[model samples]
Target: MRLLIVEDEADLASALRTGLSHAGYAVDTAATGAEALAKFGVHAYDLVVLDLNLPDGDGLLLCRRIRSVSGVRILMLTARASLADRVRGLDHGADDYLVKPFALAELLARLRALLRRDGDTGEPVLRAGGLELDPASGEVSRGGVPITLTRKEFGVLRYLMSRPGRLIPAEELLEHVWDEFANPFTETVRVTVGTLRRKVSSPGGTPPIETVIGRGYRLVDR
Candidate 1:
C-alpha cells in the first residue's frame, strides 16, 4: 500500500519511512503542512500517518482538509493523551489515533487493524485460477505450489489479481506500487512485471498476463 507520513521530527519521520518501507509499503513523507499538502495533491495514498503538530499549521486542520478531499485512512499521532484530545482528533476526521512514545510494533499493528476492519480497504485474499495470494501473510502460490517473490513483485501481482480482468496501465502500477521517487521514464515497471510473469507462469503455452501492444496489461485467469 502507498502511504503519506506528515511529521516534522526528522528522526521520527525517517524511522517511520524506513519501517513502513521494510513492511512492504510505498511511503513518502513531508515534514511540514505545506509539503504534506503538495504531496497529498499529487499522490493516491491508502493511508496517512499524520502528526498533530506541524511547522506550518495545526495537524487537525490538515486532517480536516484531507478528510474533506478524500476518504483515505488517517492515523493521527500526537503527544497529547487527554481523552478530549483524542475526541477532537476523531472529530477532525482521523480514523485512528496514536500517542507519541509508542512502540513501532504497536504502530504497525494499529495500522493493520485499521485497514483490516475497514470495509472498503480490507485486505482480502485474492485468487485467479490456480494462483492464490494471501495479502495478510504475503504468500503467493500457483496450483498449491509456493512462489517466492520480492516485495515489488508481490505488490504488482497483488494489484493485478485484485482487479482481475481490468486493464491497468503501467503508469498506474508505478504510481501505486512504487514510491514518488521512482523514475517515470525508466523501464522499471515493465521489467518488474516481466520478471513477475516469468515467476508466476509455468513453462507453457502462454503467460496469463497480457500486454496489449500500446494499451497496458491485463491479467487473464486460465
Candidate 2:
C-alpha cells in the first residue's frame, strides 16, 4: 500500500517512513501541512499518517481538508492524549488517532484497522486516470462513460482499482479471487490481465497493466 507521512519532526518522520517501507509499503514524506496537502492533490495514497503539530497549520485542519476532497484513510498522531482532543479529531473526520511515543507495532496495527474500515459515500466509484469501476452494481466506466464487463472482468478491474499503481502478482490474484486451490501459474494472470487491458485501455493505447520483467503486473494510475 502507498502511504503519506505528514509530520514536522524530521527524525520521527524518517524513522516511520523507513520502518513502514521495510514492512512492504510505498512511503512518501511531508514535513508540513502544505506539503501534505500538495501531495494529496497529486497522488492517490491508500493511507495518510498525520501529525497534529505541523510547521504551518494544525494536522486536524489538513485532515478535514483532505476528507473534503478524497476518500483516503487518515490516522492522526498527536502528543495530546485528552479525551476532548481525541473526540475532536474523530468529529473532524479522522478514522483513527494514535498518541505520540507509540510503539511501531501498535501504530501499524491501528493503521491496518483504519484502512480496512474507512469508506466513502456518494458515487461508488474506484477511479484511476480515466478508468472507473462500481463494485456494488458491477459496472465499469472510463472518462465518465459507461462500459460493459463480464463477471471476471469486473472482479479483475475492481481488484486493480482497489490498489492503483501497486504491482499485484498473478499468484496473489489467483489465490485471492480465483481459488486458493488453483495452481500459481503466470499464464492465467497474463491472459486475464490481457483481456482486462483490452477492455479498459483506450483504442491503440498502451495497457495500464505494466509488465515488470521479473515481477508481476502493476496498474499504472497515469
Top candidate by TM-score: 1
- Steric overlap count per candidate: 0, 0
Cα-based lDDT for every prediction: 0.86, 0.74
lDDT of 1 by residue, 10-40 (tens): 9999999998887767889999999999999
The alpha-carbon lDDT assigned to residue 22 of candidate 1 equals 74
Question: Once model 1 is optimally superposed onto the true structure by TM-score, how far is the C-alpha of residue 14 displaced, in angstroms?
Answer: 1.3
Which digits, one per residue and each the tens of the lDDT, describe model 2 over residues 26-128?
5788998888888787666778898998889888889899999887888998897999999999988888889988999888777656655654211356777
Regions of model 2 farther than 4 Å from truth: 118-222
Error of 2 at 83 (Å): 0.5
